[model samples]
Target: MGDFKVLRLVTQGELSWEVETRYQQCYQLTRKTCKKIKDRVTVFQAPGGFLFDIFEIAEVKHWPDTDVSEFTSITEYVDKTLSGYFFDQELKSALKEKADFFTFGVDVFDVNNDKCFSHVELVATYDTKLGKVSCWTGKSYPTEDQKRDFINCPSLETHCQRLNGIRVLVLGCHDLNMFSPRSRASIAPGTSKEIVINQMQKLCDQFKPQVVLQHPHATDSANIWNAGWAGVRKFLPEVKTYSSAIHYFNTFGGEPRQPLTTVLNRTATRDVQNIVFTCFEDGGIDLV
Candidate 1:
């Protein structure tokens, strides 16, 4: 049997004439229903609901804020939560039959230093409709001279062709380094946001991706969202963007114990009107 979770919106102080009465009535009905249903029901109340007298009769669980740091933990939590709501065998069969999953790895290196400068190690794509999976890899330079060398490379055109029409683009750290004014200062003297913009434009012209995902640990700078937005806008003016960073309070902040995958899966299943872009600080899975 599937478990049922209820979310009730609660407000403080004396109930308003009509709205408060309606909410109270709804709460009463829910409470009565749960009493009859017993074990299968899980009741949750928002913070301000303490004033409600229903506390005496109904065992209400307070909704707690959540924060998660590790990727593997989040995935495990998500899978477990999903099991409570969806049958494991049925969900797996459905996903296999309906979802198109793709994985890509990105890395940026300082060839001169023989070290990886920045990178986003994992990017996974989720689509229920598309059947083909494709990947394109390339190295970017920090200076105009290095960029010119890239332009001269014969493989550039071929890679672009493979990337063309891809609906999503996942960027690693250092991919948006030029967008950071501080980082740009360390590159060739004339390396400006314009140069970065032009480079992005070239990629956009060829690939025309609809969404961009940025991983939190992939970059060297503190402002991942700003740099990512600036870079992606050059190629896709209205492209949807998302990041995996845990800094944003609304998206990825709370009690550290909350599973990151639960939030991502919830977002993916929401009935939004536009294309959805899911990102993670370390790793994530999406069902698009």
Candidate 2:
């Protein structure tokens, strides 16, 4: 178990009904490829963090079609999505069978449609030593209710204690969008580099992570790419960073507009050897 290595899977592109099958195929292919290279994998684990999982459930419920002007009828979307039509039973079973740890992202909005808070949740981790799954939910941005719940939540307290030696942080594509000047407009207005830096500072202060993973899909220019890295380093100085260039494969005509290899290699200096780059073809850079 100690010999396991970390395998980070960075997915690109938006979710759609047309490419849903292909997306699942790609995920399975990636998992199989990783397994062939090395088994006994654990995702986010030290030395080797490769594990197999199935399905990503992202759904929004009770969202107003137009401006509702009230925060009423808000429901747990995950439960509804899981129970609704088109939900993949096989995939859900596979996830339950394969996933030992689960990470969730939460965004809270007010009646005015403004994002009041955003947080990441780590929950229900498997303990190989204990030979059972331990239940927990660790939240990054805790609300007053969450804080009250945490006080009475033994599992959450245990999870926090278990994270003492862990020092890795994972960022989603939306998180990476903050670094791209062109893409920043696609996100919330007034979202600037400073806002992103402040968020990173909050996370850094809470986690004190030694390694940061940045997963962005498409970067049009070298300047944009470097700016993304600079944004991360500015908040978390001297931290080792790992990023995936998965967008190269998703480009129109399945061809990159620019030579991704050239860009990655040029940026990979000895001084920044820790800032490793990877792609879908290569699976990922081995952390071990």
Candidate 3:
């Protein structure tokens, strides 16, 4: 696990769907910490400090164990504890160039040999485009709703509405129905059930998400995908869908001039459907 290395500092903030403020902060932090992986280990200030899960970007291991003991403070963990022990030989210059744009709010971290490497950068000074400092570590961020995982369409819609302002975006993986590389070899009722449950749980836990909108067909049940009407009968049997809280809409077959509409607006405006919830080939959308 200690062998886990920083791949490269990915510079494409727009591609990562990060907010401009957070994006720029990540860029600055990367610049300050851009040392040849073999030269020195870098650390920075984690705004909320190490308590948040975002501190694991360093790819250290047994991270949860460290939370209880060691370090004078979260800042000390990065600047002193981990940084002090990190040998210059551990880093390789070739890999630093591969780092990508990341943020501290989403709390990106990785485990490596009882140590967790967190890419954190908190800004004490505020600049218009550079909000309260951030990071560029690569990790899954929350949806517009600030939710790591989602259970039903209502939750998905709720997330979308919250992202109306700013770069917050709502995206889905369409076309591919319930297929993950992790579950490729088997086919069973238990397998399908487990797959949905595991995916739902992990997404929520790691991402700490609100809505995880998935196609109804992705589930073991066949009746759920009838235009997303099923709405988590099995995945969330206890939850109730409040009519006032949910919005249902379709994203297909609109005028060429004005297509992709949601149920939020009655009129067919061009911007109304700009952000449609989906279930397609890729699902990497965010506010930026």
CA lDDT of each prediction against the hidden true structure: 0.30, 0.34, 0.24
Instruction: Please identify model 2 stretches exceeding 4 Å from their true place.
Output: 1-20, 39-164, 177-196, 219-223, 250-254, 263-288
> Cα miss at 23, model 3 (Å)?
5.6
TM-score of each: 0.34, 0.45, 0.22
Give candidate 3's error at residue 100 in angstroms.
33
Q: Clash pairs of candidate 2? A: 4-48, 5-48, 5-49, 6-48, 6-49, 7-49, 41-50, 42-49, 42-50
lDDT of 2 by residue, 1-288 (tens): 132224433333322222234334434533333343333333322110112112221122121111111111121332233234222454344333443332222122232323322112322243433333343232222223433211111121222222224454544333443444444444454533344434555655676655444333344334445655665565555455344333333344454455654544432232222112233333323211
Candidate 3 lDDT trough over 10 residues, lowest sum: 239-248
lDDT of 1 by residue, 181-267 (tens): 445445554544345445655766767755443333322223434544554555365454333222112323334332434433322
- In model 1, the worst 10-residue window by lDDT is 54-63
User: Which window of ten consecutive residues has the lowest lDDT sum in model 2?
Assistant: 63-72
Candidate ranking (TM-score, best to worst):
2, 1, 3
Each candidate: RMSD to true structure? 19.2, 11.2, 17.7
**Candidate 3 residue runs with Cα over 4 Å from true position:** 1-20, 23-231, 242-288
Give candidate 2's TM-score.
Answer: 0.45
lDDT of 2: 0.34
